[model samples]
Target: MAPHTRYTRLAEEALSPAHSVIATSQTYDGAAPFPDFPDDDRPAPARSGGERLQVAVTALIVTLPFLALGLAAWLLWGTLIRPTDALLALALYVITGLGVTVGFHRGLTHGGYRAGRPVRIVLAVAGSMSFQGDVIGWVATHRRHHAFTDRPGDPHSPYRYGTHLRGQLRGLAHSHVGWLFRNDPTPVERYAPDLLADRDIRAVSRAFPALCVLTLALPFALGWAIGGTWLHATTALLWAGLVRIALLHHVTWSVNSLCHVVGRRPFRTRRHDRATNLWPLALLSFGESWHNLHHAEPTSARHGVDRGQIDPSAAVIRLLERLGLVRDVRWPSPDRIATHRT
Candidate 1:
């Protein structure tokens, strides 16, 4: 057996009985039941244990080269330290990194803040560099996750399996990258109609592959311009290119795996979800570690609402508002926060 289309199967099994309105299903009548529920019938592909393990092992192996390079760099730091290299790494990291946190996650996925037309396009392009996927695709998948959460339909939830250690480890790996290879993708029409309807956004989404190439190439180009050597270019490519992306991937995925599986859920969510605020990823994930608050109040501009919590993404939104590039901000009120407290 295999999974069929998400809405199709869902409508057939649980739509009318559960609710009068079918948001994802196309069929609608003023006073009649849905006559056509999409038959969620699809072929089930088979894979050997060795083949599955091969995928897991390959993910591990792909990361090793970057780890080795980082170790080597650390070992030779003083001798190899170069001002240009340091600056290059910092610039790329901040630009591309914030592009993911601010642009992809907050702007596209949740609509936490609105950017001006120019900023919106630029952020979309920058986010494409992180190589997650196009803005529309990413938004659709993420919205689906929020809609279903840790329940049966969640695209990636660590709690899908039991809470044992082995289950946790396996679920963690699945949420991190294994879900990408899965056949199912969120139905964009249902989940991301707003993004799909925008022409400029569609243009950027279509250019994603080219943007990914530009992302990897730009660092080396800058390195060669500054250091005037192939060696510097190679090192820049390694550290700011592969290593930067690898680090970002894990940090972003940790929100799905580690945040769900551990940390403190101070706020109440749908009974099924176990969102938590894991402090260590706060800065790296741009205050997205305040996952519990986010799941509790998805559209709110600020996630780090606690006394000492720091949300850089919210800070960026504030700055954008100051510049008049973003408006209709939705900062969470203390009263609202208190209401959601568990």
Candidate 2:
């Protein structure tokens, strides 16, 4: 029985030993450490006062460059919006935001679908452009979210505090952007072992900072090549770089905050989770606004499973499938949809 039990638990144990192991250790290496398991389960120490202060201060500092650029745009460009700059920013934002939604969240994090080698590479690069942490880190945090949605261990749940208005506001703030400073990052080995095993994903993740620079710099380079001026490049940097990122950031955070707070709940979700579809954010979030369906069917390839729900991400997936770039997509079926539907 012991040997059979061990073999049965091998896969789950490899992923999260704590969940499979039921025993405890008195002490090891001068501290308590479980034996017979090769994983660590201790909660990482929270940030110190100074570290937290530094993060808050740094967040404040980052706003200055964008503010300065905004001021420049007001004084120099006047009220006239440049078509070229707007187009460039629009293109970049769409490409990069899809990378996070279709690539990082759906593909990498949830295994909702599989992409061919070329598609995988392109998605990875696109996600890198979004300037979120590497693929491994993103997957880790996301898997943690699914594992403990709206619960204590979740990385960014809006219900962490309480149900009062002030508490919800505080929780919303934390889930939006404040948690980055306080929450300990999810361990890649435990949550994203598959990604860590892949050399290409690791390489891309390790080079994330460089990719972010390229994300910002490429627009400027394109602008310079087209308009033949440093000023044009600067404008591209502002519209495409700062504004685009700000837009994506707010929308993504809304999925963590607003999705849980407001909108229509048309699908049944686990108790205590209030994910809903906020229609206004649909286009901006690239079809991610079908929050109720998403929480109800996390790995379904399409979140917008009903009428009047626009899902650009699903369209992209369909295009890729038509191009023979993705296979075995776990699209929602009528039976499954009916089962989970409200």
Candidate 3:
């Protein structure tokens, strides 16, 4: 099947009432049996050398950026931050952040809008630079999250351990970053078959490792060229490359942890779907902290539908639409928003 056709089919399936039934039926408490997937049905495979290497690599990827904080602080203690490094960090953060919010989450995962081939590819590439994971895997895991929400099948729900205080604390850690270390994997074929069928998307997903290298290398190269010093290059790699990535990482994870556990639920969602509108994280998360409305209407392009809510991702989508780069945007109307309101 054609990529666009598959996308349309998946979008329809996601929005269909039947899909809601499937989601609701899958809901369970912690004691429920493991989800019925091929991976879970079979005996677990022994860890291979490659698997160990992957875990090590994942640890490095997750912690290296965070370690850069200490290095950055040391650098700051010695001298004032270079203007170029700060500016470069800000620019890359915005670009890569929007790439995730608009590209991976809104467009590819939910079909909030349809972009041309080039635009879609560019967005995928940009999002890949954020070091979140390959585009296909990211979409798959997120789709699964939506399918089960805070229930048992969710990949990273803070309520996974139950509603008790200690369980919530443990679940918060699990939802925030601990889940990345788990052996469980979301099946791309089941959750993101549309993306898997797209040649361009597959190409971008394959290029993820290269994009990860480039994301760091670009800052170093630019800093050297701009400042003509190795010191400048080092700082830029630290600030723009690692520190910026770390910041975005935590902010994105906060939407998973904090947004679900604590925040105003002004919009009604599925049973046990405790997504909330976290205003404090609105700007940092590119408006994704408006989780209540998003869960209420998954395909809506504008997450922050109410007044005074700053949705930079939605603004970027609107700009792309006006520039003729994207079409068929699913902007929610007032009536639609009202229907979801508490």
Q: Choose the strongest candidate by lDDT.
A: 3
Evaluate all candidate structures by whole-model CA lDDT and list the values in order: 0.72, 0.73, 0.86
Best by TM-score: 3
Q: What digit string (tens of lDDT, one per residue) describes model 3 on residues 1-342?
A: 645456656754654334433342344644333343322345456678987887889899999999999888887895888899999999999999999999999999888888999999999999999999999999988887887777756779887667788778888999999888777777788778888878999999999999999999999999999989998899899999999999999999999999998989998998878998999999999999999999999988999999999999999999999999999889999998998888
Compute each candidate's TM-score over C-alphas.
0.81, 0.83, 0.92
lDDT of 1 at 87: 72
User: Model 1: how far is 223 from its true place, Å?
Assistant: 0.4
- Backbone clash pairs for candidate 2 read none
**In what order do the candidates fall by TM-score, top score first?**
3, 2, 1
- lDDT by residue for model 2 (182-217), tens: 645567787777778677788889888788789889
* Model 3 C-alpha lDDT versus the unseen true structure: 0.86
Model 2 residue 121 lDDT score: 72
Candidate 1 local lDDT, 235-267, one digit each (tens): 777767767777777788899899997899889
After superposition, which runs of candidate 1 have C-alpha atoms over 4 Å from their true positions? 1-81
Clashes of each: 0, 0, 0
Cα error, residue 210 of model 2, in Å, equals 0.6
